[model samples]
Target: MPVPDPEVRVTAVDPHVSLRTQEGARATPPRLRDVVMAYVGLTKPRIIELLLLTTVPVMFLAQRGVPPLGLVVATVVGGTLSAGSANALNCVYDADIDERMRRTRRRALPRHLVSQRAALVFGLMLGVVSTVMLGLLVNWLSAGLALAANVFYVVGYTMILKRRTTQNIVWGGAAGCFPALIGWTAVTGELAWAPVVLFLVVFFWTPPHFWALAIRYREDYAAAEVPMLPVVAGARTVARQITGYSYVMVATSLLLWPVAGTGWFYPTVAVVLGAAFLVESHLLLRRAAVSDDVVDLKPMRLFHWSNMYLSLLFVGVALDPLLTR
Candidate 1:
């Protein structure tokens, strides 16, 4: 009682603190449901579904309006799986940046809902399963393309280009283009310029499409040090860049008729849709240069419309052979 030694007291407390830390470390692991959700979130399943929508119709065209149902199923499953893999990998790679961006701050990684190692392993497993499924069930060509897309998205876009330039989405978008190609190949067991044209359409569309999101989230992107067009270039310059890409996208969509051998129906819808796209581009450009009016709602409007544009454009492709002269 006269002297409970300070050193002995301190040593006793140290063991308790260490035990507490160990228990916390063990207890902090995520629940199984959270881990499952993290896996789902990585795939960006909704986006993959939309992208795969283009695949079925392209397969129909590749097979001259009747694709094997079995092949179609294989292609869709493989494409969706591979896409989810890429998305998951991106989430894992960008976890730190995701934390800094307000829009992405609540993502699985930033929330500590999933660990990085888990995400990476899950992504790689999805890719391998998808690629193998496509190769054995669909065709080697389709599987090869899927593998290439996964590699490009993970190694090329997420790891390299996303941090390097405003054109990241422009080039990185190639990964998304493979679904059209995969669908076509799954049916025909061969590649053609038609899918390539379809690929270019999505490729060119990505810049303008993504730039709208960038405009809305400019501050977040800048804070996170992501080199999105709006962050790397001033708003005005980014606006001009978006307009230019929109023009290219519109024109590329029209080429589907000539290059992919579609009828006038595709070109006609493309014309009207293309003009609408151009109008949106002009609005984004004008607002960025001359006004700060959220009245422009142009970016948001265009962002929504771009999705419709691609959907309808693909629908037009699907309907062309049946409806056209």
Candidate 2:
């Protein structure tokens, strides 16, 4: 008070100025809508949608017609939560690599919109809630299967296999196959050969389906140091592998018809769809063989078609029972 220090000199605050505003600028709290959307983005909703497509159709197949609306709803809800948990945990674990990849750089964690600790807690919460909800509303078997899938995806795939092996998605993909079993058990309370066949269908389908996307992002994967097939193998080699797996996937799909005792309609659809899938895969192989260029490879064509292939194939599964009935 005796003398003002030159370094510490300050101007008097205006009486009209609010004390909060006078305390230096504070960051605007994130908008509520933005916060909600960020959390939803963390769950990777589109992947969950694809997983549910596999799930509900199997429930319909298991019931051999329309399942109870309540049971269907509960199973779907639990499955979504479980898948979300797995995906969120995956995003958290992969955040470091994600920031390095152009395709994944925009995700919440990489963008700094959400903290890793918060995401981890959210993922674990979803897993617990899904398990409890399924056990209470559906059946314990389904709940157990969902929990197993979550563990396999988070621990088996994300942590253990993703970065270390080119064959990572091949075996780790079994996590996705669990939905077929979960859907079947939700209705029948036991596993069967039919769902097992469908499980194999998805298991074989995984490599080709994911490798196509990897073809498009080979550089991103190389930059991230991941050993995806495309990152380590020549385009022709990856394409050949894709075509081979496509053959196995189609063959496995047909097994479901005989194993589940489905009628003419299901097999007919399976044949048509399988033929189309084979054609597309072979086209991808031909393209890769002829050209090393990603643009010429046109990998996304197969990527997009694979999504439709699985969705429509499962659609066939759902409609088979109702149509045959």
Candidate 3:
């Protein structure tokens, strides 16, 4: 049975008492540390880490060696705030369905650790601060791009696309790609084909990365009425799409080698990493071919590997300039 929204009260034997009223009466005020952690949780730090991973490496590549220490620090700080703002706003909008989904039920809003209004205000504040910081410390172009990405993730992905379509993560995921552009522009103060190539690489990588997790949480999304690809489509179909996008992502990663005119080290690393990514994606397809069950599918294997693949691949990106020099 589906869980009822928390706002709805269940009647008790006395009729005058309710489950929520009793629970509220029993609840104690949250401790200071717990309150601080709850606000931090709204930012989704792990996701921000991944965004920054793509960021700093591109800055290295753009510089063709070490980027200035001050610029790197400023860009990272501004990027963190910008990404945090988008995520916090996303939590505010998704709080209703988040309560119904098992995977997201423990988030701050669903757990009632923070009020919706407080989260909304906090998100807006972060965005404004990040934009101003980036404009002043980094560059106005980087700030503008970061602000655009923040708006797109919150308004475009979270509000418009997520609940409405199966292709939600495909287009919505573009917001995550901005860090590449931001990283490059922070170094050069302008856009170029090299960063755009990295942008496309992340673009194609998002679906496969996110869908693998969605496959694991298919039931939760169904319960929440979100139309993630795994929820509406068959396991085999979703796996096939994952495989297809994996090929394109690998191809795009290679484009950076030529577009940036990097040394042989980058392409060699890209090839090895791309091969492993393909193998894992195909393994998921093979598993889906046999059984539709989540247990049998073991989609998390690909999910976990995808994280390493992107991280190591970008590590190669950062290493190439130094090694070649």
Candidate 4:
């Protein structure tokens, strides 16, 4: 049987009342801690961390050194809330497919720990508060970018593109690039060639990064009828597309050196990181080319490595400004 709904959603439940069953029998109330954890999970904190990783380094570089502590704090808080809003809204929208997929079945909406109504309210509140905070405390430019990202993620990606095409993540991923732009604008109060290149880097990087994971969980997407690339294409085709995007991603990273006029530190790190990323992509491609079955793909190897590559590349980006001084 499905878990019975509480009189109030998990996030708003009264402390003293136990959750009741559908049959009207008394059930033990979930601890406040569990309810809190469920709410946090709705925001997809791990993804927010990755998004913010790209965010701060760009701010550091834009400042040409350290940014103001107050501005940084305000931007980080606003960015966190904005990202949380986008992610929470995604959960609310995708709750149907999420329940069908093994990976996302435990999310708050699917488990009924958070009602759709509560989730929608939480996301909207965060988005409004984040935009207002950034506009007043940081800058209107950053606030605008944050609001735009929320709209793209909620309306453009989650609502329209996601279920309609195998290329869902490709264009939808554009929304994720806003943080780099927002970070740059927060400091300079305008756009520039440097942040534009960073935006492109993320845009190209997203497909390979996400597609590798999609390859690993192809069946989950298939079962959910989400039509992710790996679900619709053969292993070789998916791997080839991943390799193509990986090439563009690395080439784009190299362009940042010449265009941004960064020091040897960033170029050197990019070369080493790009080489490792390419090597993994090639290995996955070779496996897919030789194997008749998707089982031989080992796409997760590249998926895990992609995470490390982005982390390392951005770490280099963060250090370049300070070291070049």
- Candidates' TM-scores? 0.87, 0.91, 0.93, 0.91
TM-score of model 4 (CA atoms):
0.91
| Per-residue C-alpha lDDT of model 2 across residues 1-325, encoded as one tens digit per residue | 0000001112344423433344445377657787688788878877777788888999999999999999999999999999888888888998888766666665678656688999999999999999999999999999999999899888888899988999888988889888889899999999999999998998898888888988887887898899999999999999999999999999999998879999788899889989999999999989987898999999988888888999999999999999988
Shift in Å, residue 214, candidate 3: 0.5
**Which run of 10 residues does model 1 get worst, by summed lDDT?**
1-10
Best by TM-score: 3
* C-alpha RMSD between model 3 and the true structure: 5.9
Q: Tell me how many clashing residue pairs each candidate has.
A: 0, 0, 0, 0
- Kindly list the per-residue Cα lDDT of model 4 for residues 222-260, writing each as its tens digit: 877888888888888988999999999999999989888
Off by over 4 Å in 3: 1-26
Most accurate candidate by lDDT? 3
* Candidate 1 lDDT for residue 98: 71
